[model samples]
Target: MDEERILERERYQIEQIRQLELEELQVEEVDSDDSDDDSSSENNYRTSGGASASGEFTYDTSLVALHSYLGDVEDTHNRLAFLDGGAVLKLPMFYLEGVVLFPEATLPLRVVQPHFIAAVEQAMTQVEAPYTIGVVRLYRDSPDYRRPPRFAIIGTTAEIRKYCRLEDGSVNVLTRGQQRFRLRRCWIDVEGATYGEVQIIREDSPLRTPREAVGRLAPLLNLRSNIFQKQPLYSPRACRLGDWDGNDSDAMSEESFESELSLHERGLHQSALFSSYHTIHEPTSSEDEKLDPDGEVHQGSSRLDNLLGPLREYNTGRDSAKSALSGNSGNLSFKRMKADKCALDRLREVPRAFWPNWVYHMHDSYTLAQKAADRWKHIVKAPSMDGFVMKPDLLSFHIASKIPVSESLRQELLEIDGISYRLRREIELLESFDRVRCKTCENLIARRSDMLVMSSDGPLGAYVNAHGYVHEVMTLHKANGLAVIGDPVKEHSWFPGYAWSIAECATCGSQMGWLFTATKKKLKPRSFWGIRSSQVADDTR
Candidate 1:
């Protein structure tokens, strides 16, 4: 059987385990009230960024990126699936900045996550987007810990409606929650864990506006500021930017709730400090805003850059990939070079890793190295550099937390030349941490279900299998897009990548994973293979 088929079976097993776990967790939470107890269950401690009195919100988003991402709206088929599920998710449980993706609704969010930072960079530098993100509750310190870990529990189905890399490296995400999905289970690859499957269990109702709750979002904004100051409610910045009307909360009826809240709702909605909370329509203006953060860059420029960046690198690796495919091993040729990309245009939301944050000139260094590799052989192909690793040491640098695993090792990896015995040994060491984070922020895609994927804007290998399952690691001959990777006929599986069907994110143009590859692979290439996430069920082990 092909690798995807095997992964499908593995994912099946995971689904069964999660079903029982969720059921049990529900039963256990019936009368629990221990704040510190289940608080740490998944990831529950939200940041100090509660609703501020003066609209103060600091994201430490030195890692933010303002970039345009292309993502497809959850079509009618996907929307209908959610209505049936009644889904609402609370993820990264440590503390979720995430919201519900109601059908027909779009949300704009500011993200400063490490993985997302990387994602934004890729979107700007590589032209990627409209991908799926796995969000689970912060359940690190829960009692029923051993059930089955899942990144999909009560997950939100989202599409990138708008994304921007702020001037401060902060990211603004405009997403629409299409539906809700509950975890069945999650499969883990030797490299990392992959989402097994989810049950679309929520149907969305029209965003009902209770009359009294009907005010141009300005009043509601003031009321929100007064109430949930300590809870995970809106920040002043969010309220200002987020256009909402009164009672975005349908949980309470306007008539009785309004009457009861009369004295409280007086001038301030007068509803004392005890309230509430709150898609995505990409207007032409917003679309233009997303694409050209400051109008300095164009969509074509970004896409061409992304497409060229990898193909250029592939050309350098052409010989080895070709040799590997043809079963030939040798004193492979290699190159020593540098490639760097400056935010020539003041792109606001560049990821922190790429921003001049951790290591100065880091992105520049990488880009230059990549460019060096590309140009080293341009007019006249350089034999010495072809099969060689491009800044292998720099590639492996700890771009994640801005710390290197071993400066010496990275140093050695970079200085070394061919695949000599010494180079081979060093390569192995460099290759040690092959698994990329599906939980991303820094040039990485955080782990998720099958069919979902991320590109290798970083080392270890871009294009990680975010589905959180072990990949079949198919060796392809060229750089390709998810469309080709997700085709069922190509992989011969019943499902495309992991979803029954998939669509690319229109905003960022990140190849939403599936069985397709519009990306061109110059010579020798390889790709990861896994099951589609839509098919997962109770894989209870």
Candidate 2:
């Protein structure tokens, strides 16, 4: 009942905004002197936002209201998922600055520009039930004006969930990211709207070292054999199997080690290599349970001890022989003792390649997932992880959507091809992402520990300006190397109870972002700094 009442109130507010837009549109029409402009305007509403005779944008004052009463609105009830199965799509492109959308993130846009408004309407009127738009980040520093604006080759497809048309013909759209894509080509149409032919990117499944590979790695992990396997008298593998009954048995041969795995086992191992190609989440079969319970092949040296229990008993006998060799007076050991100690010393000189890279615990998906979840807990305050660590693929996207980093780093995460690779990259970035610096001059601005979470989306969030430029900014409690340039203005502030002032780099005079101060006395944060992602340096590299 409470939800219904809240939804009803939202509907009322939307109707009120529509009525206000109608009145504003009527007032603009009355102020205009050209009466015949209505017929021509209706015929060319789509073309007005596009290229004109002078190759410039035709700003329509009649479409914009004096003020917008609408706040960010999203339709979560009727959400749609994109599942075309890795097919290519031709979609309308919306290039934004400092914004990189990952799958499952939400983007709110105000379509005040004529070209964008036309794009929104075109998406809505399509035959498809769920309309999708390709969103790419624009490089704001690009100086080439003759060609199209430089944008990222990689982008995310956003499905329109809800849209509201205003009286002046502008639109407010709420979209949710569905899938990632690689832009093949992009061009501007005759009506001035941009379109792109994109191929959807398919992420590889979470990785796992095969059970047969674990069996092969067992010989490398046998620490006891590593110490004394070269000795003519002491072979741990032979002693454990009763093949060495103290009659000077030779050390186990490499040919025997290779023959232990049958042809059937080798075939199974080869098939497991490409198993991740077919599906995102493969079911765990009974054979998969043979691996370590934690999915980590090498948990500790204790795991090595547990694998060689029989050899451990044999080692006890060798220890007693060594003790007997020393007299009650504790005399120096003979040649055998010296050889044993030398082999023990050689243990420290084991080649790293002998252990094999797949045995590393850090390369495991579940291990990386848990580390990422723990790191996220240390950074953010609320929202329990609740089973997120179990799904490494989902957790990778969730962290990429909200991690407080520059747009370039976020785009790198989006372009990552594998789940384990993405998680590893994120963990490395989270560990090293300490300070935010200026992108142009590399001047230190603020520490990541000083970041303030102003939104549910974490320390960084996307907010659009009056000119329809979306700036992804990170909120910080304190910042340096910045100079506030203008008096605080409360109008159109992204934060409801804050007034904003332009902020610029103190050394280079480049526009950094805005300094926001709370207008209400009761607001908890008295003041904060917003630094644009584009201006921030990509220290993750």
Alpha-carbon TM-score of each model against the true structure: 0.19, 0.63
Write one digit per residue (lDDT tens) for candidate 2, span 157-272: 89887666767776777787888889999887777777888888877666554222233322222234544444422222322221212222323343564355455553443234
Please give, for residues 1-541, the per-residue lDDT of candidate 1 as tens digits. Answer: 6857955754553453333223311111111332222213232221110111111222111111111121111222211222344333322211132122222233334455554455433333222123433433332222255864333245445555445455666555544445445666654433232323455553322112212223423223323322322322212222231223334453333343334433323334321111220001112221211122221223344433442343234344555656755777533333311111112111112221111232222223333334333443341131223332354332222221111122223323322332122233332332343222211112222122111212211111111122212111111111111222122222221111111223222223333233222111210111232222111111211
User: Candidate 1 local accuracy as lDDT?
Assistant: 0.28
Which 10 consecutive residues of model 2 have the lowest summed lDDT? 45-54
* For every candidate, C-alpha RMSD to the true structure in Å: 33.5, 16.1
> Candidate 2 — what's its lDDT?
0.61
- The prediction achieving the highest TM-score against the true structure is 2
Q: Give the TM-score of candidate 2.
A: 0.63
* TM-score, structure 1 vs. true: 0.19
Find the 10 residues in a row with the least total lDDT in model 1: 273-282
